[model samples]
Target: MQTAQTVMMVRPAAFRANPETMKSNHFQKSWDGDLDVASLARKAFDDYAASLRAEGVEVRIIDDISSQETPDSLFPNNWIVMLADGSIFTFPMEAHNRRRERRMDIIADLSHDYEVLRRVDLSRYEDKNLYLEGTGSLILDHDNRIAYACRSSRSSEVVGREFERLSGYRIHWFDARDRLHHPIYHTNVMMSIGTRFAIVCLESLSSESERRELISQLERTGKNLIDVTFAQMEAFSCNVLELRN
Candidate 1:
């Protein structure tokens, strides 16, 4: 029933400033070696917006808070999720660079029209070395009240479990691996679930039991499967969101 009429995406200001992943984290950037980040990001911004528009979705394009120099602002799901009930969640991110992306000004701008409810600020957990990077760490099955997550430093089992308890979502979990044979950092970068369909790269799941569970859950929920290869996943195929459509 979510016809996702309006969606938002941030134009990447510092395309190559994702220093957390490049410097601190284990995740590798595919185009880091020889890519003109600003140029590539601009094209990607256009293309991403076009793709969403092609689906008849209205896009709310916001240039990232460049003055703040917040990298990874291109992926906005971390900082906010405007809910059907008009509530907004301000999530906590594990990466220090990402944590800086949250700004009250953006939230305040959004509150002009939407009914503002409680702000669930989870940043306190970060002080304890616990974190949950919003939709990046948890792909919400909003209709079913489920949150599918892969345990990582960004998405701790403890945190995901607590979210299940708080949000009343059943946790569909798995331990997945990337090409380098390391666990993928964020869950949303690997798989996405929707009401009518599911787009996933089953090959990324190295364990048979884990893969089976992920597939079975989708199938049981009556979803049409669109399986992609790990190559496609690397292309951000898993990053595709089935908006309110």
Candidate 2:
């Protein structure tokens, strides 16, 4: 089967225009420009999502509840993935604010179209003091049975392996770090996989061995590598959604 034509985008509760996210070299910053951050964020969110819809995607737009003070609420994929098979896996987030982002009502809302095949609840990991943000942790090549992940508080071996066990994917695990030697919080920040290609910043992987491993996984899966520099990755360039067309 092919990928879904649906693209899900959460409206930005904390909308603002930030230059930092436009390029990868710097830490993506919060909006401090003349425009009201919230307003700009809302416009950007709408425009990007509208662009996707224009491409014939079946987009589901959910309004963000801003009063709750959830800054990163716009990135919905961190919380859920509505599989074509109808299974919904709600992720356990490392950040407290994100926990509110998942509402069963949202899943219930989606049940009308998608079949709920499986529910893999890892939120208990939060009590155990571990985490793994859904697609943020794992870049899955759905058709190829491959999953690429970088270990972080939101991406742990225990949870990642558990997902593999349920999804039956081959895991290619590695440590990804930034220029300062700190681990990248999300694998999606450094790379993304499309049906035919990948956009990645290979240098972000601290170890030569891990870099090799990442490249090997991509190559073995027959993905055309569209390599980006660490400069590009930080721009959230790797945080892409390959929607159903």
Candidate 3:
């Protein structure tokens, strides 16, 4: 169960660069050219879904609430994670507005198709200011039962430990920084783990030891490591997802 055959996506209703997330997510920028950003986003989403469906992938598309003002709701993966074992985990988001992206109705919709044995809600940690934004903060190697996460505002060690305890997956924690020396907001932005391969930006690791350890672990687990440069990482070369068709 390293990869999923079915995936969920949210159609943007108010698709614009979120100011609340921009502070931590350096990759995001405000829309300068106004050609109807929401319209363009919708078209892109439709094309992406169509392409995935053409590839024999099951894509569940959900529409965002227009009045919610949750611009980043398009990324549903950050708030909720569904495991192959019928376990659902809800994460605590760092961005205030992003927190609203989590909807019980979506979970209910999913329950109609999938058997949800248990749900672990980690949003209570948000009261303590500890956040771990689902797959955004952690890159999971489900087949190997290993989780990789980089230290960042959105990814906290305390919450990571809790995730490890709840999910029964060992986590390898590391520090990663962008080219500008700022902590990489999300681990997914710097690395991705597939069934037999890993795409990572080794240059993003702040510590040499951490970089070596990550490489060693990936190699030990029989993963073909494809290293990318900082520039390529910034271009989202590492932010990739592998799905089973």
Local accuracy by lDDT, each model = 0.76, 0.76, 0.92
Assess every candidate by TM-score: 0.87, 0.89, 0.98
Among all candidates shown, the one with the greatest TM-score:
3
- Window of ten residues with lowest summed lDDT in model 1: 23-32
lDDT of 3 by residue, 1-245 (tens): 78889889999999898888888888888868858999999999999999999999999999999888899898898999998788999999988988989999999988888899999999999999999999999899998899999988899999999999999999999999998998999999999998899999999887889999999999999999999999899889999999989
Candidate 3 residue pairs that clash: none
- Candidate No. with top lDDT: 3
Off by over 4 Å in 3: none
TM-score of 2: 0.89
Q: Give candidate 2 misplaced runs (Cα > 4 Å).
A: 15-26, 31-34
Error of 2 at 29 (Å): 2.3
Residue 134, model 1, lDDT: 83
Candidate 3 yields a Cα-based lDDT of: 0.92
Q: What range of 10 consecutive residues in model 3 has the weakest lDDT sum?
A: 26-35
In angstroms, give how far residue 220 of model 1 lies from its true place: 1.5
